[model samples]
Target chain A: MRSDFVRREVATGLRRNVTMTVAMVLTTAISLALLGTGMLAVRTIDSTESLYADRLEIQVALTQDVSAADQDCSQPICSGLKKTLENSPLVESVTFESQQEAYTRFQQLFAGQSIADVARPQSLPATLRVKLADQQTGADAVRQAMNGQVGVRTIIDQRDVVGKLFDFLGGVRNVTFALALVQAVAALLLISNTVQVSAYTRRVEVGVMRLVGATRWYTQLPFLIEAVLTGVVGAVLAGVGLVVAKFAFIDDLLAGIAQNGVIPPITIYDVLETSIWLLPIGAAIAGVTGYVTLRLYVKV
Target chain B: MVAMATVATHEGSSLPLTLGDGRGGIRERSPRRAEGAGRTRVAGAAPGTVPTVIRLERVTKMYKTSTRPALDRVSVSVDKGEFVFLIGPSGSGKSTFLRLLLREDVPTRGRITVADLDVAKLPRRRVPRLRQRIGVVFQDFRLLPNRTVGGNVAFALEVIGKPQATIARVVPEVLELVGLEGKADRMPHELSGGEQQRVAIARAFVNRPLVLLADEPTGNLDPDTSQDIMLLLERINRTGTTVVMATHDHSIVDSMRRRVVELDLGQVVRDESRGVYGVGR
Candidate 1:
C-alpha cells in the first residue's frame, strides 16, 4: 500500500475514535511514568549500596565514669584501650573523636536545628570509630573482642543501621513496582479497547478490503501501526514526566538535605537512565498488547 | 511473533483438517500438504491458453447447527472471460457458494479451485491474493463513507500496495469507464442508490480483476435503474472479465438472455448457455 494512504488511514482512524485514542495514550503515559519511577527506585537502591558498602563505621562510645573530668586521655586504661585497637589486625584503622570534636561535629550536623545552639564542648562523649579491614569477618571479631572491655560503654554497629537503610529502599522499590503493575494492566486494557473500537467502527472498510483480497495483515496494518505509534508517543510523554519530576521534586529535596550529607543525592543521570529504559518498555508494552489483543479479540 | 511473521511470508502449512461427507458425517483424511509444493495447474487445464478461472468439484458445505447441507454436492466451473448468473431462492445456497469462492468458509467435502489455487487448501494468509483477482458487488454498496468516489476506487489499489502515480492515473480512467467522471469528488452518501452502486462497481473493477462476483447488484434499485446497472455489468463482461452475478431479478435475467444457472434446495437444477430466466417454467 502507498505509505501516504496508510498514514491517511491511520490519521482518519485515530480521528474517528478520538476519545478512545486519547484515553489509550493517557493511560499508556501514566503507566510508563510509574514504571520509570520503579526503575529509578531500583537505581537509587544500587547507589545507596555503593555509597555505604565500605563505609560501615563502628562507633565505640566511652562511658562517663571513665573520662568525665578531662577530654585528654592521660589515664592508663584509656591509653591501653587505644593501644589494643591499634595492635589488632582486624581493625583497619581507629580514629579517636574527642569531646570537643564530637561537639563540633554535632553542631555542624544539626546546624539548622535548635538543639545545636545549646550543645557545648563538654556535653558530648569521646569515642573511637573502627573501620574493619576484612569487612566480611573482621567486624564480627572486633565486636566480639570489644564487648566486655574495660572503660568501654556501648558498641554501635553501623552495618545494622545500613541494613535498615536497605530495608527502607527495598520497601520503596516494592511499592513502586506494585503501582506500576496496576498501571500496566490499566494501559493494556485501554489499548485493547481502543483497537477493538477502531476495528468495529471501520467494519465496512475492513469487509471491503477482505472481499478485494487484501491480506489480513494489509487490512489490519493501519490499526497496528496506529497502536505502536500511540505507544511511542506515550513513552515520550512519560520520559518528559520523569524529567520534570526529577527537576521539580527530587532535585529540590536532595538540594535541601545534600549540604549536610545525610543521604547521597540521586543524580539527574538516574532520571535520564530511567527515561531511556522506559522508552523501549513503553513501546513494547503497547505494541505487544495490541498484537495479542488483535490476535485474540479482533477477528480481522 | 514467529507465527505472525510467517503470515507475512505465507508459506503453506501442513495443518491437518477434519473432512466430512455430505450426509452430516465426519471423517479424517491425511490430505495432501502443499508447502513448497509447486503450483499444480488448476484441475483440468492445458497450459498457455486462457486458464479456467474457477472450478468446484463435488463441493459440499454443511453448517454444524443446520440439519441439511448449505451446498450439497455442488460442482461448477467458469472459464476465463465467461459471464454466468446464479439464480436461487433465499436459502438455496447462493451466498454460501460465493463465500466458499472467497474462502470465507471451507467445503465439508471435495475440492474448490479459483484461479488454479485450491481454495479449500489455500492458507488463510494467501486468501487476500486470491481475492485480489476477484471483485465483489453487493446489494448495499460498501463504499467507505467518508471518502470521495475516486478514493473509493483507489482504495482497491492502495490495499494491494499500488503506487501513487498508478492510482492517480488509473482512478480517473476507471471513474470515466463507470461514467462517474464528473462525480469523482462526491461521497457515497451524496450519490443516489444507482450512483453508489456504480461507485462500488467502479472500486471493484479498478484493479481489473480476472473475475467479478455480484450478489444482488440490482436488489435495491428500480427497474429502470437496475437496467442501467445491468448495462454497466454487461459492458464490464464485454471487456473479457468473467462475471458471476447472483440475483432474484427474474425480469432482468430474462431481458439479458445470458447464461443462467438456477439452484434449487442446495443443488444446481438448471444450467443453460444463452438461456432466459424461468425457462424451466
Candidate 2:
C-alpha cells in the first residue's frame, strides 16, 4: 500500500477510537513514568554509595570501669593502644579524643539536647577516631589487632552505616520496580485491546483488501503503526512527567542534602538521557503487542 | 467462447486427490503443457491440444459438522479464455468450487492445478501470489466505504507494489473500462447498486488477472442493471481473460446461452457446451 494512504487510514482509526486510544496512551505514559522513577532510585543509591565510601572512619570508644577501674588515657595502657593504631599500615590517621574534647564536640553536634547540658567533661568517654587507608576494606585486620585491648569498649565501622543506607535504598528500589511491572502489564493490555477494537472496525476494508491480493502484512501494518505512534506519544508524556516530578517533588524534598553536597542531586541530564532511551523502547513494545494480538486474535 | 474443454483425468471416484504437507498425490504433467496452461494463448497447438488452465480431479470437501461432502468426486477442466457459468441450487457446490480455485479452502481429496502450479502443494506464503493472478466479485459489492472509486481501484495495484507512475497511469484507464469514467471521485454509497457493482468489477479487473470468478455479481441488482453487468463481464471475457460466474438468475443464464456446468448435491450432474441454466435439471 502507498505510505500516504496508509497514514491517512491510521489517522482515521485514531479519530474513530478516540477514547480507547487515549486510554492506551495514558496507561503507557503512567507505566513509563514509574519505570523512570525506579531508574532514579537506582541512580541515587549508586552515587551515594560511591560518594561516602571514600570518607569512611572507624570510631573506638574508651572503656568505662564502673565495676572496678576506670580508663586512664594518660597512662601506659592508653598510650600503648594509641602507638599500635598509629603505626599500623591499615590505619590512615588516628586522633585521640580527651573527655573534655569529646564532651565539647557532643555539645556542638547536639546543642538543643538536654543530655548535652547534663553531661560532665570527665564523665564523657574519650574516642579514638581511626581513618582507614582503604575506605571499605581491611576492617577485619584492624579489629583482630585490637581484639583484647583493655582501653577499648566498642569498635564502630563507618562501612556499617553505608551498608544500612544501601539496604534501605535497595528496598525502595524493589517496591518501585514492582509497581513499574504492574503498570507495564496494564499498558500492554490496553494497547492490545485498543488495537483489537481498531482492527474490528476495519475488518470490512481488510476483507476487501485481502480479496484484492493485498498481503497479510500489508493489511496488518497500519494497525501496528497506529500502536507504535500511540506508544511513542505516551513515552514523550511520561518523560515530561518524570521531569516535573524531579523538579517539583524530589528535588524539593532533598534540597537540604543536595545543597550541602551530602548526596549528589538527581540531575536533569539523568532524566533526559533515560527519557530519550524510552522513546524507542515504548514504540517497540507497543508495536510487538499490537502485532502479536493481530496474529493471534484478528485474522487480518 | 471456450477454446478447449478437456476430459476428466480421473475415471474413478475412489482415488482421493489429497497431497497435503507434501505427503502424497504427486502427478507427472508435461512441462510444455504446464507452460501452455500459464499462458492465455498457445500458438502451435491445434483445437484438441489447447492448454487446460484448470484441472480438478476427484475433488471433495467434507466438513466435520456436515455429514455430506460439499464437493464430491467433481472433476472438471477449464481451458484458457473460456467464460463458463456455474449454475446450481443453494446447497450445491458452486461457492465451494470458486473457493477451491482461489485456494481459500483446500479440498480434502483432490489434485487442483491453476496456471501450471499445484494449488494443494503451494506453500502458505505463495497464496497471495496465486490470488493476485485471480479476481473475484462477491454478492455484495465489497468496496471500501472510506475510499473513493479511484482509490478502491488503485488499491489492487498498490498492494502488489506497482510503482506510483504505473498506478497513476493504470487506475484511470481501468475506471474508464468499467464505465465509471466520471464517477472516479465518488464514494461507494454515492453510487447506485449497479454503479457500486461496476466499481467492484473495475477493482477486480484492474490487475488484469488470468481468471476472474464472479460468485454473484448481479445477485442484488435489478434486471436492467444485471444485464449491463453481464454485458461488462462479456466484454472482459472477449479480452481473453477467462471468467467463471456462479449465479441463480435463470433468465439471464437462459438469455446469455453460455457454456453451463451444473452441480447438484456436491456432484457434477451435467456439463454442456452452450447450455441454459436448468436444461439439465
Candidate 3:
C-alpha cells in the first residue's frame, strides 16, 4: 500500500484508541515544555549578551605627574607611544592629555579637593590615551604595543566585564539543557508505557494481523502515529501554559526590574516564538520514544 | 473410475488416487509400472497425467528450541481442486505443513513447490505477492475488534492496494457468499460464535485466492456450528479454490470423504483417499 494509505490507517487507529491518544499528547507536552524552556533560556542569554556587548566602549584613562627631566622625556615618550599604538592596527584612536588638564578633570570629580593640593599640577605626569578598535581587543595586546616605553605603566581592557557576564550566562544555559534532558527522558518513558499498555490491550488484534501476513511496520505505524498526535496536543497545551505563565508572571517581574536597570528584560514575543517551535519537536520526541520503548516487548 | 498413472516408475510400483464423480461417489484409480519404459498407466487413461498443484520433495522443518523437527521429510503432491484435511496431534506439525505451503515458514531441508513457484526459495519482498494467491484462516478467527464484519472481510483486499470501489463491491458479494450479508455492519463482539467464524471464512474467500488454508478453523465452535463452517468451506472448494484444512475433528473429516494427510511425531504415517480421522473422535 501507499504511505498515504498507511498514514490514514494509523490516524484512524489513533483516533479510535482514546486513552493512548491522550497519553501521547500529554507526554509530548511535558517534554516539549522542558525543551522549549531550555531553548528560550539559551536565546535569552544570547540576546542579553549581545545587548551588553554592543553597548561596550573602550575607555583610555590618562595618568598624571612628571619631573621636568621626565616631562621632556615622557612627552616625546607619550607621543611616540601614541604613534606606535595607532600604527599597531588595533588602536582605533590616539588622544593626548596634559597633566594640568588631568588635574582640572580630577578637580571637577571631587569639587572640594583643589588641583594644587591633590598633587602639584606642574608636577603631574602627562600621558597619551589610546582607544582600541573594538571592545574585544584585550589588554595584553595594548601592553605588548607599549612594552619598554617609559612612563606607559599599564593598559586595561573594558570588554573583560562583558566576558564575565557571558561566562555567567553560559552556566545558565548548561543548567537549562540538563533540566531539559531529565524531563525529556521522563516524558519518553511515561508515554512509552502508555503506548505499551495500549498495545497489550489490543494484543489480540495485533496477533491476528501477524498471523494474516501483516509486516511489523504495518502493525507499528498506528501506535507511532497516535503517539505523535498526542505529542502535538501536549505541545499545544504546554505552549498555552508557558504563554500564560510568561504574561501573568515573568513579564511583570522583568518590567519591574527594568526600572532599576539591574537585570535585562525578557519579551513576550521571544517566549511566544520559543513556545511555537516546540510543538513539532515535542511530537517527534514523543512518537520516537513511545515507538522505541514499545519495540522491546512487541515484535514480529 | 479413472485408473492412476505413475511416471518414472519402477516394477511393482503403483500410485493410488480417488477421483470425485461430481455425483458424490468416489472413483478409485490404480496404476502399475510398465516394463522397459519408466512410465505407468491408469486403467482408464494413458500415462503422464500432470494434475498435481502442490508438490513437496522430502520437506522438513525444525524450530530452534526443540530437539526434534516439526515436519520430517514430507513428500506429497496434491492435485488441483482437491479438498484435503491435515490431521495430527499437537506438535505433530500439521500447522507447520500448512505454513510451509503458505510460505509463512521455510522448510529446513528439501524443497516445496506451491502453485508452480518454488515457495521455499521465494524472496522476502515477493512473499506478499505469493501470499495473495493463498487465503489463510486461523483457529482464533483473528478479526480486528474495532472493524465491522464487512470491514474485516474487506481488509485483505485493502492491504493489497485494491481500489475502494472494488473493495466495496467485492465485500458484499463475499459476505453474501458466507451467508453473513445482514451482519455486515455488526462488530465482532455483536456476532455469535458461528457468525464470527463465518466472517473469518468470508474474509479468507474474499480475495478469490487460488488456495484456501484453514488451520483449526472451527476448533472453538460447537458441533453444529463447525459443520456449518465446514459446509461453507466445501462450497468454496467446489468453486475451484484448493482447500487445505487442518483439524482434530475426526467426525468432520470422516463425513467429508476427502483426502486426509495424517501426521504423528513429525512424520506422515498415513495418506488416504477419502480417509477417516482414525481416533480421538
Candidate 4:
C-alpha cells in the first residue's frame, strides 16, 4: 500500500466534498452522543437500584388509638406488634418511631411545603420500620405476617415508590434510544451518498488508474479512509459533547436529586467510559457503510 | 500530406530505439512465459516456434440486451514485437476486440490469451497483474485534469506500488521518449489535444509493458497531429513493445503499410500483411 498516495487521496476527497463530509460528521456525532447518553442512563439506573435496595424497608403505621396511648411503644398492643415483627424470619431489624418523632420526620420531608405547617405532633401516626434481609420476597412475607394485626393501620413497601422512579428513567432511556436510532439511519444514508458522490466525481481518474493496473482495493481504499476519518472526527466531537453536557447541563439539572440521593449523578468517569467505545463504533459503522455502498452502487 | 511526411521524418530521428534489439529484450523481461512456453502450445504451430503474445481462438461476446453477439468466433494471433492495427467501420467489434484483450469484457465463449496468461481463466485477484503487463490507452486521453503532466504519468506507477525513486527516474525518461520532456509541469487542460495524447502515451509506456493496447488514440486529433502521434507509436513499436491499436482512420492504416485485421459485423473479414485500409486501395 502507498500510504502517502492514500493520504493525499483521502484529503482531496474530503476537501472536495466539504459540505457532505461535514453533514455526515455532525449527524454521526449526534447519534453517537445520544447513544452514549442512553448507555449512561442505564448505568445510573443500575447503581440507583442497588443503592435503594440496601436502604429498602417496609413501613407499618400504627392505629391512631394505639399511637395516642403508647407514647413510647410501651403499651402492650404496640410493644407486642413490634416484638412480633422483630421475631419474624424475614425481618432483619425493626425500629419504632414514636408519634413525636414521626411528626418531626414529616416536617423534614415536606419542608418548605404548606403541608409541613399543617401537620401537628399528635396528628401523625407512630410506625414500625422493618428492614429485610432480602428485598424481593421479604416485603411480601412481612405484609402477610402483619396483615389485620392489632395496632397496624397500613403497610407500605418502599420498593413501590422506587419502582415509579425507575419507570420514569426507563422511559427516558427509551426516548433517547429511539432518537438515536433515527439519527443513525440518517447518518448511514449520508455516509453512503457521500461515498457515491466522491466516487462519481473521481470516476475518470479511477478509470485511468484501473487501466494502468491498479487493483479494485487500491482504487477504493481512499474513499474508505475518507469515511473512517470523518467517523473518527465525529466520535471525537461526540466525546467532547458528552463531557461538556456532563459538566454544563446534566450536573446542574440533576443537582437537587443527586444531593438528596434519589438517583446517582452522571459522573465524568461514566461519560469517558461510554465515550471511549464511540470511536471504534463510529469508525466501524462508517467503514462498513462505505464498503457496501461502493460495492453495490459505485464500481470503483 | 507534406506536413505528414515531414513529421514522419522528424519522428524517425527523434526516438533512439533504446530497446530495439527486438524479441530478445521483451522475452527477457517475461520469465513466466519462458518457463510455461512448453506447457501451453498454440495449436497448429510447429514445436519450438516463438510463442505468440496475444491469441484469440473462436472468441465470442454476447451482451444480454442485444440480439446479436458483439464479437462472433473471432480468431487472431499477434506475435511478439509486432504492430497490429484493427480497422473497421462503426459497430465492427473493434472496441469489443480490444476490450476482450484487456479483459474489461469477458468472452461468452472461446479462449483468449495475452502475455501467456489465459484471459478468461485468470482469477479476479490476478487481473491487475495481467493488466500491468499490458498498458491501455483510450481516445479521450483520460489524463487526470487536476494533475500536471508529470503527476498524471507518475500516477500510473504510483498506483502500482512502484517506489518513489523509481517513479522519479522513469517518469522523466518516458516523458522524454514521448517528446513531452519539458511540458511535465503543464496541466492537461493547458496543453493542446495532441500534447494531451502524448501525455497519455507517456503514462501507458512508463511501465514498459509487454503489450500496449490503444483504442482510437488519434480519434480526437487533427490529420497533421494524428500523423505525429502515429509516428510516435511507430517509434515506440521499434523498441520491441507489441502495439495493438483499434482505429477507423484509413489514412493511417494505408500509409503505415502494417498488418491489418479488418472486422465487419463482429467477424474478421480480412487479415492482410502490409495491407491498406480497404481492398485495392
Best model per DockQ: 4
The parts of candidate 2 lying over 4 Å away from their true place are A65-105, A111-124, A128-149, B1-49, B60-68, B107-109, B279-281
Tens digit of per-residue lDDT, candidate 2, span A20-80: 9999999999888888888887988989987886687787777765111333455777777
User: Judged by DockQ cut-offs, is candidate 3 incorrect, acceptable, medium or high?
Assistant: acceptable
* Candidate 1, residue B146: lDDT: 82
Cα deviation of A257, candidate 2, in Å: 3.2
Q: What is the lDDT, from 0 to 100, of the residue A236 in candidate 1?
A: 89
Candidate 2 per-residue C-alpha lDDT over B1-281 given as tens digits, one digit per residue, 9 for 90 to 100: 11121122222222222222121222212223223233455544454465667778889998788999999887877777777789889989999999898888899998899888788878977788888888989889888888899988888887776888998899899889889998899999999999999999999999999889999899999999999999999888867778899999998888875656778899876564446676433
What TM-score should be assigned to candidate 2? Answer: 0.84
Q: Sort by TM-score, best first: what order?
A: 4, 2, 1, 3
The 0-to-1 C-alpha lDDT of every candidate, in the order given, reads 0.79, 0.80, 0.70, 0.84
Among the numbered candidates, top TM-score falls to: 4
> Which lDDT value does model 2 have at A70?
33
Docking quality (DockQ) of candidate 1? 0.56
Q: How accurate is candidate 4 locally (lDDT)?
A: 0.84
User: In candidate 4, what are the lDDT values of residues B106-155, reduced to their tens digit?
Assistant: 99998999987999898988889988989888899999999999999999
Query: What does candidate 3's lDDT look like per residue over A177-280, in tens digits?
Result: 77768777767777777677767766766655554556556667777776776777788888887788787976786676445543466667877898888877
On a 0 to 100 scale, what is the lDDT of residue B33 in model 3? 13
Q: Which stretches of candidate 1 lie over 4 Å from their true place?
A: A60-91, A96-104, A107-128, A133-153, B1-50, B269-279
Kindly list the per-residue Cα lDDT of model 1 for residues A73-99, writing each as its tens digit.
667766777778778887888888878
